[model samples]
Target: MTTAYCFDLDGTLTRQELLPLIASSVGLEDEISVLTEATISGVLPFDKSFKLRVRLLRDAKLDWIHAALSEQVEFDRHILDFIASRPEQCFVVTGNLDIWVKPVLDRLGIQSFTSTARLDDGRLDGIAHILHKGDAVSSLRDRFERIIAVGDGMNDVPMFEAADWRIAFGGTHSPNRLLVKLSDFVINDGNALCRLLNML
Candidate 1:
């Protein structure tokens, strides 16, 4: 039977979040930072807020951002190795754009479900679609006998609820108490992430 493991990208996979870096890449730090704050605070809806940020930085060169993102994104390497040991079942399910997370995802060689953006004249035109992450997991459940999800943000709660096992990574976001209350497992350290995965 196939088992599926879905992971969030931002704080779950990196020491720093992607949007702020994408903003800084093109000197739109002020605007994106506000959107990031609003997103985390629930001031703005996640998808609309994220789209606004992307549009603001639409002129950024995807290549430059990807190269720069390679240098900026960092996270627990050991958890990665743990996933590598069981490659067939692991995947990334994020609200982030695929292009921005491509470098890190490529490095891990994992399949992903993420938002998509359109490009025009070597710049982002806008996000073409938002990946309904929880819906993605719901659909994947038909193919997998068991599904596990790990994440640390408001957007993840829905996916977490759909999982056979749900994990909140406090090492990243300030997880919602409701999510933690429902989680089968909660881990705060990166090394612990491997243990949680192994147990599943």
Candidate 2:
């Protein structure tokens, strides 16, 4: 049976969240983080919080955002290497804007699904569409017999529900309590995570 692994970008694959990094580029990290925390903890809906965060960083220089992400975003090398070995079976599923995260994703060189950005005269205008995590997983049902999802936030709940096996990762910070509750396994180290992926 074919198996697909769906991974959340921030905190799951990478050591930190991308929005806060983007916000830091514009000197609004603290403010954006408040909204980010609310969204992660299930206090705010993912779509609403994502739009609000994007709006707050609208004026940030695109070049600076790219440079910052290129410099700051750190992927779990083991997980990335595993994906590298079987690129077709691994997918990055994130709520981050496509434009904002392109640089990092490009470096990973793997397939992904992200929220697309609306552009206005060559600048970011707003989110054209928000990706619901569950929808991303459901779309892959026809291709894979088993789906394994790894994530750390409330937004990943839907992904967990859809997956045949779920892992709540806390390699960076503690995973959302709710996500952990639904997880088939909870792991916090990159090496351990890769091992679990192999076994799954």
Candidate 3:
């Protein structure tokens, strides 16, 4: 059976979250982080929090945002290398907007499923749709025999539910408590994460 690995982008695959980095680029990090924290803690819905954060960052220059991400974001080398060995078998599943995260995803050279952004005159408009991560995993069912998911947020609950193997990673910090309860394994080190991915 063919197995596919789905990874969450923020805090799981990367050492930091993307939205805050983008917000920091435009000097709105503190404002955006309030909404980001609420969403992750389940105080706000993912779609609503995402839209609000996007609106707050609407004026941010794409070039500046890209530069900030490139400068501050660091991928877990061990996980990055593991996926690099078989890019086709991996997918990045994130609630981040496609436009905002394109550069990072391109750098990884892997397939991804993310929220779509509505654009107007080459500028940010609004969200076209918010991705339900579980649906992304379900869509992969036809192609892969077993699917493994790794993430660290409440938003990742759906993905964990949809996947055959679930891992809650704490490389950046402690994973969401609920996600830990749902996970088959909890890995915190990059090398250990890579080994778990290999075993799955």
Best by lDDT: 2
Query: Backbone clashes per model, in order?
Result: 0, 0, 0
**Poorly placed runs, candidate 1 (over 4 Å):** none
lDDT of each: 0.80, 0.93, 0.92
Deviating ranges (above 4 Å) for candidate 2: none
In candidate 3, stretches whose alpha carbon ends up further than 4 angstroms from where it belongs are none
- Across residues 17-65, which tens digit of lDDT does each residue of candidate 2 receive? 9999998888999999999999889899998888889889998989999
Model 3 has an lDDT value of: 0.92
- Per-residue accuracy of model 3 over 17-120 as CA lDDT, tens digit each: 88999999989989898987887777888888887898899989999999998888899989989998999999999999999998899899999999998999
| Candidate 2 global TM-score | 0.98
* TM-score-better candidate, 1 vs 3: 3
RMSD of 3: 0.9
Candidate 3 lDDT trough over 10 residues, lowest sum: 36-45
TM-score each candidate.
0.91, 0.98, 0.97
Pairs with steric clashes in candidate 2: none
Residue pairs in collision within model 3: none
lDDT of 1 by residue, 1-200 (tens): 57898888888877677888878888888889888877765567788888787778777787878887888777778778877888878888888887777887898787888898777765667787898878889988767999988887767777887888898887766765666877988888889888767766
